[model samples]
Target: MTQAKATSGFLDQVCWNSDGLVPAIAQDFNTGQVLMLAWMNRESLALTASEGYAVYWSRSRKSLWRKGESSGFQQRVHEMRLDCDGDTVLLLVEQQGGIACHTGRSSCFYQRFSDGGWQVNLPVIQDPEAIYK
Candidate 1:
């Protein structure tokens, strides 16, 4: 998070899946908000540590994606953590522009399960079209 270099073999220490990816969760450091969930390959995780930003492996695109590269709302890494099993990664970050979800909401986890139904709990801070374009 401090632009510290990821040690060699550090990526290997993570328990990678058969697909060579790990589940990554990004949280707002200041507000304790769960910003988003993503996937990170070795290279993306390494790059994220070295670059001090959120970089994820896009399963759909089959490529690495730097978060907010186009939306101008990059996540600055404040801390990186691994679950006890070492299969999941948690990143405490300062979210730029207060937007994390591609849908332009504060977080990807905008749904609440209540009354035996799923309800939207968060409002979109900005429209996707407005953010992406």
Candidate 2:
């Protein structure tokens, strides 16, 4: 019997850490804005490419999970890139439905400190329950 071919081309080149994980940065393809940063193991990487959605490994949770799985806001991948060192991944994505952040903001980096303290740059686009439910 013929062996099945692996679709994960260049995956062997990636530099996974001692924990078998790599950092993944999600960015907006259109806006060139960074949405979020997360970690991914081999399984998450394969799942993200195959499933065509952003999947990541949660270090704290110690499991695999699809981004926005519990939320209605999903990130459809536009492109996946590897950094020069091949230790990091950049995922250009187009978010669906609503904001990407759990705080209901468009991005996690919506806060900017002015002369003194932090300030909210953008208001919450939707309620957490609305997207999470």
Question: Quick one: best lDDT, which candidate?
Answer: 1
Reference-based TM-score of each model? 0.97, 0.88
| Index of the highest-TM-score prediction | 1
Taken over the whole model, the C-alpha lDDT of each candidate is 0.94, 0.85
Which stretches in model 1 have alpha-carbon errors above 4 Å? none
Per-residue alpha-carbon lDDT of candidate 2 for residues 6-125, written as tens digits (9 for 90 to 100): 377667878999999999999988998788889999989887877778999999999997888888678898778899999999998988864889989889888899989999898899
- The residue-by-residue lDDT of candidate 1 on 1-94, one tens digit each, is 5776668588878999999999999999999999999999999999998999999999999999999899999999999999999999999999
How many steric clashes does model 2 contain? Answer: 0
Q: Alpha carbon lDDT of residue 29, candidate 1?
A: 98
The number of clashing residue pairs in each candidate reads: 0, 0
